[model samples]
Target: MSGLLALLDDVAGIAKMAAASVDDVVGQAAKAGAKAAGAVIDDAAVTPKYVHGFEARRELPIVWRIARGSIFNKLVILLPVAMLLSVFAPWMIPPLLMLGGGYLCFEGAEKIWHKLSPGGQGHGGGDVIPEDAAHLEEEKVQGAIKTDFILSAEIMTIALAALPESGLWFKAAALGLVGLGITVLVYGSVALIVKADDVGLHMAAAGRLRATRALGRAIVRGMPGFMTGLTWVGTAAMLWVGGSIILHGLAELGWHAPEEMIHHAAEAVAHLAPADLRGAVGWAVKAVIDGALGLMLGFVLIPLATKVISPAIRAVTGRAAKGH
Candidate 1:
């Protein structure tokens, strides 16, 4: 009886420890998810375009399919690779993150360039015809997955960096939780955003109340602006996160010029503002500086990506131009 009672006590202790570990993982995963907010927002923002030319009925379905692919990308593909990296070659992470950061910078910069130079959308097969409706949907979904792979890699790396120092199992648990949580948050929001117009249309047509119909009309009108705002926000986030990563990377590697300059520059700018507004001013200045730096780095990288990397990728993958 005493031995059985001791066994029960041990089991209870294990359960307690397991519960504590679960709590810790959840908390750490939240922190990790927050760290990857830029990639998360960009993921959601960029996905809608994939469904743009499709039928309204097809939009949510395409998003659902893409979201599924994104989950697979994160969990089945990236998760194992991330775990292996952590186990064996953890030192390689910063360099890999820098690479992803550079890509983000390039993307953000390229977008700005495209906006400035109307004809510059010449890269990335913007000229190609959609083969058919089904083919087009497949093409867009595939493109979304490819893009998700890059952004997911960035998010996973950021999440891994933000994770609390722990055992391999704990780290893996936290990362997996972060991955799952972020995918749900991102794609779920995408689903809602894509469906908002339909919801508004239904309400506008079918609602019993005049005020409800008015609100629905407002929603339909407001959605376009909201989507545009989301795009700009996503772009800004890409720059902020990408630049911060690069700056942090340089600081890690002992090149503190960017970091110190931004810090003092923001502080100097903040001093010009009233006392209560100083903190907000400082943050705005710092973000602006970081984003500007990111844009500059991105601009530099875009040509290399287009002229050099694209050709090499084509040679290696042996894939022809993607018909958009």
Candidate 2:
């Protein structure tokens, strides 16, 4: 009886530790996910276009396929790579983060450059009409999954960087949480956005209540503008987050002038604001500075990426650029 009681106590203790570890993983995952919000938002914003022009019944199914791909990208691919980096080459994280940050900056800058330049590359949504129904669906799913892989890589790196020092298992658990949680959040949101029009149309056509019908009409009418707004927000976030990461990374690498200058300037600006608003003012000022820096860096990188990197990618992959 004594031995059994002792064994039971040991089992209970292990359970308690396991529960505590789970809590830690959840808490860390949330923080890390928030830190990657810029990419997360962009992921959510970009995915809906993949389902465009599909049949109403097919939209959710398409989103489901993309969601499954996204999960595979994050959990199966990114999570293990992140853990390996953590264990074997922790020092590589900073440079890798800066690389991802630069990519974000470049992406945001390229969009802006396109907008300002005459006949800049247009943001092409999927085919307005499928060229070959089955093939087109497969192509769109492949493209979306590829894009998700890039964004998922960024998200995982950002999450890994944000994590506090912990055991390898703990870090793995936290990243798994971050990966799976973010994939679901992003694709779940995409599913809703894609289906919202159908939902609205149904409500508009069938709702018995006048207000309900009106609300449905509003939703249908509002979606285009809402998506556009979301795009702009995502772009801004990319710039802000990218620039901030680069600045911090540079500081970590022993170049502190930009970071310190931005800090002092933000403090000065904050001091002029009312007490209640000082923190917000400071953060806004810093974000603006970071975004400006990101835009500048992105502009610098544009020629290199286009002239050199794109050609290399094409050579290696045996694929031409998609658009003329």
Candidate 3:
């Protein structure tokens, strides 16, 4: 009887520890996911365009394919790579994170510049024979998956950087959770955005009440504007997150001046705000400053990326620029 009781107590203790670990993983994953918000938002924003020109019936299917690929990118590929980095090259994480941050800043700034410049926009897809719908759909899915791989790499790296120091297995679990959760959040949102017009149409055409029909019509009309707004939000988030990461990286690398300056300035702004809103005000001020810094860095990088990097890649690969 005594032996059995001891065994049961041991089992209960183990269970309690396991439960606590699970909670820790969840908490860490949530925090890490939040840190990667810039990449996540951009991923969701970019995905919808891949389904454009597809048949309505094919939209959901295409989304599913891309979502599956995103899962593979995050879990099968990026997660293991992140784990390896944590184990073998932990010191590299900060620099790699800064590189990713710089890339995000460049992308966000380029988008803003394009929008502001006259005739800067170009439609996706170069001239080609009209391939079969099935073939074209597959091509788009492949292209989207490739794009997701880059974004997923960024997201994973950012998440990895954000995690507190921990055991290898614990870090892996947290990163895995972050990967899976973010994939679902981004692609699920994409699916909804893609199918919204269909839902609106059904409501507009079939709603029994006039008000319901009007609401549906409004939804249909609002989706385009909503998508455009989302793009802007994503750009702003990229700049803010990217700039902050770079600033933090510099501090980590023994240059604390920029970070300290930003912190003091934010505190000053926060203190001027109403007591209840101080924290929010401070965060917003910091974000704006970071975004401005990111924009400046991005502008500096644009010519280098376009002239030097693109040409070098093209020369090595003997292929045209992957502009998208």
Candidate 4:
């Protein structure tokens, strides 16, 4: 019947619309995820340390727990907050982004400063090993989750800022997709990094072929250097992304000199390159400038943070706790 034919056409049209919407969501999520690459990379690089010294069997479980906490942080807590900001306080996004970006720069520069400074305390030091291993594990997991909340906040905010102007449901869908996708990506990479050595060992010991054993040995030998490389890469990414964010935020807030100067400098540098490579060269130059600026800003902030901000915060919290 004609009626049945019309219904079929209508259903097909609806399906097409649904498919387009899904595509849009996926595209937006990818863009948003890319925008938060610095935080995401740092999350992956930092998480493996929480599992350090744990029993092999327990490593994945701890990662799983942290991943779950991360999901909760993004989806349950941060997502709604981001939505509220978008709805009610959209003007706040740039400032919040710059704050988060400053944090990234500080963290990156701090790592470098510690590396270069004499008698500097490293992250691995000063742990009071409790008698209860289980308690210690729990404490580490909680600590990691707490740390993740900050990074997750940055990631979600960056993603939200990156999203195009759209309806509530569309933004929500993109954010949810971004959160879930990023969690899976970060934790999945962490799992692999953590277990690589174990897998290598097993392969070395039990591999049927000589080549397999040799490859496994190579993996075991290579893992430490690989981790160190990952850390450095993460640090660099943080600086680059953080600096870029701050510069963009400043431009958005009506200070255009920094961005304009950088652009002109990049163009000048790009002129020397072949046309095909000019874009890439220009981008690299801009990123380097941004990172350099970020490092300077970070150094300026370091003393302020260590001497003033930290002490002030501790004092206030101390007073509050005593009053309570």
Query: What local distance difference test score does each model get?
Result: 0.87, 0.91, 0.92, 0.93
lDDT (0-100) at residue 98 of candidate 4?
A: 99
**Tens digits of per-residue lDDT for model 1, 121-147:** 444434224457888778889999999
Question: Against the hidden reference, what TM-scores do the models get?
Answer: 0.88, 0.93, 0.95, 0.96
Cα lDDT tens digits, model 3, 43-142, are 9998999988777888999999999998998889998999999999999999999999999999999999998889877566643345678888889999
Q: What is the lDDT of candidate 2?
A: 0.91
RMSD of each: 4.0, 3.1, 3.1, 1.7
Across 220-280, the per-residue lDDT of candidate 2 in tens digits comes to: 9999999989988888899999999999999989999999999999999999999999999
Steric clash pairs (candidate 1): none
Estimate, for each residue in 1-324, the C-alpha lDDT of model 4 and write its tens digit.
999999999999999999999999999999999999989999999999998877788899999999999999999999999999999999999999999999999988998898889876455534434466689789989999999999999999999999999999999999999999999999999999999999999999999999999999999999989998998888888999899999999999999999999999999999999999999999999999998888888888899899999999999999999999
Better of 3 and 4 by TM-score: 4
Candidate 3 matches the true fold with a TM-score of: 0.95
Model 3: weakest 10-residue lDDT segment is 122-131
Off by over 4 Å in 2: 1-11, 120-131, 319-324
Better of 1 and 2 by TM-score: 2
Off by over 4 Å in 1: 1-12, 119-131, 268-280, 319-324
